[model samples]
Target chain A: MTDPTASAEPPSGPPARRRGRPSRAASAGTRDRILTAAREEFSAHGYDKTSVRQIAKAAGVDSALVHHYFGTKEQVFAAAVEVAFAPALAAPDTLAEGPADGVGERLARFVLGVWENPTTRAPLLAILRSAVTNETAAAVFRRLVAAQLVRRVAARLDLPDAELRAELAAAQLVGTALMRYVLKLEPLASADVEEIIARVSPVVQKHLTQP
Target chain B: MTDPTASAEPPSGPPARRRGRPSRAASAGTRDRILTAAREEFSAHGYDKTSVRQIAKAAGVDSALVHHYFGTKEQVFAAAVEVAFAPALAAPDTLAEGPADGVGERLARFVLGVWENPTTRAPLLAILRSAVTNETAAAVFRRLVAAQLVRRVAARLDLPDAELRAELAAAQLVGTALMRYVLKLEPLASADVEEIIARVSPVVQKHLTQP
Candidate 1:
């Protein structure tokens, strides 16, 4: 099987996808491959060391093609991080269906759920590694996380300090990620998901609902 | 005037600092200078790119002097991070004097207080930059933070799951540091310290006191 994430069309199927726009970059699934390569490379080598040429080589594309689609190394990282954060970005809307009181549990479970999966966790870790080490990369991550995730959740709160509340909630989850995933400190690392959720969800609820 | 952090003895007055062990490295304050340079170099260039020769150059000493005092770049980082985290390490014990009910506020304010000061915050940001990007450096940092601070705080809580509780509290503060200091995301970043403490203390309190 050709990597299922590349495109909807099967590998044995036709060369073209999206009949209206026949751009080879999209049609051939080269962009997805490049992103996959970029995430792996960045995760392995970090932001400062990883180069556009390396990402292109890993993607089996010319450097020009990587640049044509993603611009600079920083830009490539930005795009990769955005894709990594997709589940998190959609969380506010998808988890907002319940009453505000339950928003904490819903959001906590959802955020932790993303980290619980190794596939999703890797890219997010890459984004975090880059942000912590490189200022330019940090700016990209800060903008995406703030404007895309936290601010959206804040907007749903309809409170004066909704932004701060959302940020605190983000900080809590992000901090846990650093320790449990990156640092792998136990028993936080080894604790069952249910145990963590039971302890953390109430804190999340308090941040969202407290006056 | 000599750098005050180097030693109590005047730079011009006496070469012997402790008089017990007049080791030239300790007496002349060469060790202190190396550490200072190491912290600055690591902060400026990051862990992977920095070298012992460069640190020695910045300290105005021979590379052998750096090697003599600190052994390796990673060892130098350990020493620097330990110094950087001294304030935080002292906190679990010093701040524990208050009633259990006030542990949250005292701990929150104290941790934020460490971040509030630019002098203490820089080395921490440097350590964080290294830990996120390099696995070896991350291990050094993980051990220091987990053993020196979190575990100590856990021991104090006297709860069965005190370790997890302390880790959660740490996650809260560390997360705030990433957003507020490293990422500089606002209003969390630009927001007044008092305002943050007020909003955050209650969350911290719940993490520690909630069983």
Candidate 2:
């Protein structure tokens, strides 16, 4: 493991990479460490309160290194959001796996399934909380979700106003996540996962395919 | 220091509220003024940062009177949620207004319409932001929504697991609100209200009426 503070110990705080090229694997590892730390910080403190310095400290790196790697707090947050949403953004592909009639169920199950797992749920919730409260975070989030998930999902639909349809479908899943996971609204929160999948999948299906 | 004329009916008031102070009557106008101030405070500062003193100051009432009428800050928030949700909680009756197929559109329109109105949207957004971030806020929000809206709507549905169905339907609308209003995600955010109602109504119809 790289010494997180070694570079900063020098008079100039240039990242070790700037002094000399490190092994690609080591560089990737450092990047990953920073990202993990970013996720944890963002998840715990949210976007408005979390600072790059805090993330660097958490990762045992200098704040300059975080700037070197991610440019800004907003960028770091975007990167963190990307990691959390990567799997779910692949949802359009998931939707293609089953018959069109079952697409709604598959899509519903896919989105909710991501939330069902504890490990993934933390960062997603963190991203969502930040998005709701912070304007910058929300813009970054809206851009990614709009660009990555909604538009792609829209592309898959063979319908008029496909963008609207895709977003509406997104609204269904996002809302379910808020109620069941974020707010922990009862009935929805306590209801069986499969039962929810059974009930909501059809609604999703209609949004995706129906007129 | 009690102003007998200001609260002449305090001791024998029908409201029977006895928490903040005995300085004011639990008159509807005064109670509403406190609640309005509370909603504005909570909306602007969220649950954690807002205080009874601030709410009372905004309403030109004593803090003790706020406590008197609302008991605790949590109770005050519950009261605020009740006001914002008053019309929404009565959605069961709205469902009874039109033909079965049209129910979804009517419901969708009713909800988005609430959001469309500036006066209503602000407090709702504030309440939503608070609920998502604070545990007590979430509990109060969840309880109000579950008790007031979901269960009532569930009672209207003649289906098995009616409560679950009602909650699922709620997820759809809440998610849409998160996207369109809270996050203000594009496409969905800019889409015409009628268009949204058209797209989302059938989905609601399925959730409320279908097996």
Candidate 3:
């Protein structure tokens, strides 16, 4: 619920009756705006360089509002990561929809598609870049991937060493992303998404399915 | 050749006769010393945080000497990467010694071994951290991996999509390094070297040897 007092004090308008809590939509919108700005600032400046004041400024809100919403920069970052990786966090479910044999292709398609999409790729890149440099960010990132992404996929396999296999598959896909997206290594970077999926999916499939 | 002026000066000792250009070995030693200090400083502080003055102080030399040896911070970082990745840069030759099928195992063993070795891993970890955050460092790192490491392996493969395959193999290995060494992701981080070799080599083998 939005604070009634704050909602009632509108700029260039007479004070209206402070009715019941301002709409959930308005509160959620403010939270989303803060997160979007936080993602951009963190991505651009990394965890150490970014400040709450800067994020608040970027979001066009007061610093106190940011603190009120997110508590700390770390909390804000965690929320931002959650927002950025929401699609990827859901990607493990894609494993359930397809045949076991094609899980690798589906997985690869989903990951590469995320990287190829501007919407997902931007924040993911920022998180990735931050993770690489900042220990705190890296810890958060590790938990997200290991607990949420990799482990979830590992759960799908009805086999021994399922966790290891899932991680091996992650290593291949994450490695591909490191090179193609982050490092921008040529040929691989310039290669079509389809080509990458073709070459990489089998390896993923093999890692996931092989004994 | 080391500078005659620098070599003549000794701490708490009589000044030796100022000679002509110092021996190649002496000059090389200074360069190596500077690089070692650079690696340590860069590792501890990262690229943006590290300064030539600090590096020189760490190396027991003047900032001018650091500049004299490595030209700029970028050049110093390049030299440090070269030193850190020397063994890995030479890894392609290992493929030539063994049968083609075993190359994957050999490659995995060599890479994981490098990561496992604390002596090499320390500076490498620093370079990796720097590369993730600093664009300039990333460029140097990209050149080292693409030009010196991955491309060399691709050249040895002699396959139709040799470059792509080599990179895919690199992607897997690099990804593993990212997770295990950089991110310190669980299981993989603590996973036994041989166990990882057992699991990852086949995928590397597949990426490399497959049509």
Q: What are the per-model C-alpha RMSD values against the true structure?
A: 7.1, 5.6, 5.0
> What tens-digit string does per-residue lDDT give for candidate 3 at A65-184?
677676678788888998899978877898999688999999999999999888889899899888888889888888888889878887888786887788888899989998898778
Top-scoring candidate (TM-score): 3
Task: Estimate TM-scores for all models.
Answer: 0.85, 0.87, 0.87
Q: How do the residues B165-197 of candidate 3 rate in per-residue lDDT, one tens digit apiece? A: 889998998899888887888778888989999
Model 1 misplaced regions, further than 4 Å: A1-28, B1-28
| Residue B62 CA displacement from its true place in model 3, Å | 2.5
- In model 2, which regions exceed 4 Å deviation? A1-23, B1-30, B60-62
TM-score of chain A of 3: 0.87
Model 3 iRMS: 1.3
DockQ of each: 0.64, 0.69, 0.65
Candidate 3 lDDT score at position B128: 76
Question: Model 1 chain B, poorest ten-residue lDDT window?
Answer: B9-18
lDDT of 1 by residue, A83-185 (tens): 8888778778844788877887888889899999998888888888888887898899989988898788888988898888888988888898888888888
Comparing to the true complex, what docking class would candidate 2 get? medium
What fraction of the reference interface contacts is present in each model, in order?
Answer: 0.78, 0.80, 0.77
Ranking the candidates on TM-score from highest down gives 3, 2, 1
